[model samples]
Target: MRPYWCVAVAAGVLLVSACGAAGSGAAGSGGPVKLAFVYATSSQNPFQEMAFGAKAAAADIGGVDLALSAPTGINGPQEVTQFLSTIHNSKDGVALETLTPDLFVRPLNQAADLNVPVVAVDTAPPAGTKVGLFIGNSNTELGKALGEEFVKQVPADATGEVVLGNDIPGLGLLQQRLDGMRSVIKAKRPGLTISGPFDSGSEPTSNFNNWNDIVKAHANAIAYLGVGAQDAVSLALIQKNTGRKFLAGSCDPDTSALQAVKDGYVFALASPEHWLKGYVALRLLAERAKSGKALPTGWWNTGSLVVNSANIDQIIARQHDEGSRKAAFKAETDRQLANPSGYLRPLAEAN
Candidate 1:
């Protein structure tokens, strides 16, 4: 995501005025433990899913005063400000979403000093950040899966380039995804050349324009792969509008991206299952708040889902509402609780 300077006053207004708090009364006579979910942006499908999952966890746990805070767009400083405010407000715990983990190192470490548990969501925290747990997909593995799908669709002897785009050019997670895909394409299809991990802008319009230009410039590319949801939507639309017969696939999902897969315009989607990241992060924090226990320190693998024609309908059905999502994720949640080790990987293995 592109970074923008969010005004300090604007950050305050969002934290104090716009934050949505949900709860089900008090826990342990503390008059409802205050927990906050802080993300980069609220005006996107993935973040909305995350908020729904966090709110669902609060509702399920009961007595959690869960507050959701985010800027309307990608703003790292705003997220850091909001997170520090959440901690200073005597919040019981926090679930933080950040692609730039270094921005939060000091604040997260301070939260740990105050005995406030913090869980990193969507992206893992960097070393010395002191977050108790990370709840997200194994990004490198997810990228490999997407790569495998692309390889499966294209012939082994294909000679043209497979252009790749990284929506957020410098982010570690996106880079890992690009690297993972590169490794597979290089190893499996020696005849095919991988073009780029280009700076495909994070915003929709720019992302589309970047892909459109790339597609036109490389007319005979065998495939156009992206590592972000916006890329998926843009590539699909470009494929339809230009009538290009190139293969297209990407990481994550949205209504338009999923529909592209369903319509056969796009080949598949590698969903990080964003909702599960929020759900697991909040649940772990809530348990820590209620029981006065330290959170499990490691990577909580919320896992990934590869959506193709075979399961597109099922994946679409699961996106209807919070109830639908919970029902769909129940089995995995049960496994998380029953066999935590199966899902908890070393932080080093998160990428």
Candidate 2:
């Protein structure tokens, strides 16, 4: 289990690690409720941080046996199979991230039949799915936040281009991010031509290779933006190495993204709060295990952060402290649940 905090976000791996203290108690006469976390993304820094949050929740909240798993790398078919295996393998409940919507429908329906409570983490269930809850963010709003930054930087009369690097078309969640970003950029700066939501091949090397061509073509684009974590880093490297000048921004964070922001190579970084996503997902599932009640389904936006040069260092430092991270996550979840007008909403089960 990779500790998301203290390692990946801090630019290197830690010498030692801390898994949350084991939980205690029993959900019923069947003994402790078995809980599993099945994520779609690889063991990337962001996902690791997410798992760290899940571990924290497992320790802090008693009476659940928690287990976490994901594919070895960025393999969707494996993830889909593992997702199916996880829910059906006698677990009491599950927190999952779907790689694709349709592929998991039958498994989710099976889960509902088996009385397995499921809460979606990182992405929302497709329409007509019986998943318990959705703990994520409004990608469109997140894009708007970035758009506001772009508006602040661009001159009203100056016409140029803004390029978006989005990878992995299979995941609709990322697509929403791209969609939101496109809307915001279009609405804010009509003169500034927004370019391709180009295929940023998932890994940094692939992203760099793909974006390298785009950079070669658009030598004078106004700004560069990415919907993936590595895309931000790749953009920073390309701009720095090739002397291609542009304001760089991105959708998520990793050590590379943080470094780029601190060095002023990246103007802003939108954090998806993966750690909080896992924590909240597991917490909601664990709660269901004990109470025998399904989650109030609907959207529970875990939230996002737009980090700039001024706050990059501070945010990275804050992310390293597991205790502080968990405390902040708890506070955020409490806030989302308490705020009636906020993104968090309730969905009654369809009768």
lDDT of 2 by residue, 286-318 (tens): 766766655765777777888887687778777
lDDT of all predictions, in order shown?
Answer: 0.80, 0.71
> What is the Cα-based lDDT of residue 200 in candidate 1?
80
TM, every model: 0.90, 0.86
Best by TM-score: 1
- Model 2 lowest lDDT segment of ten: 9-18
TM-score between candidate 2 and the true structure: 0.86
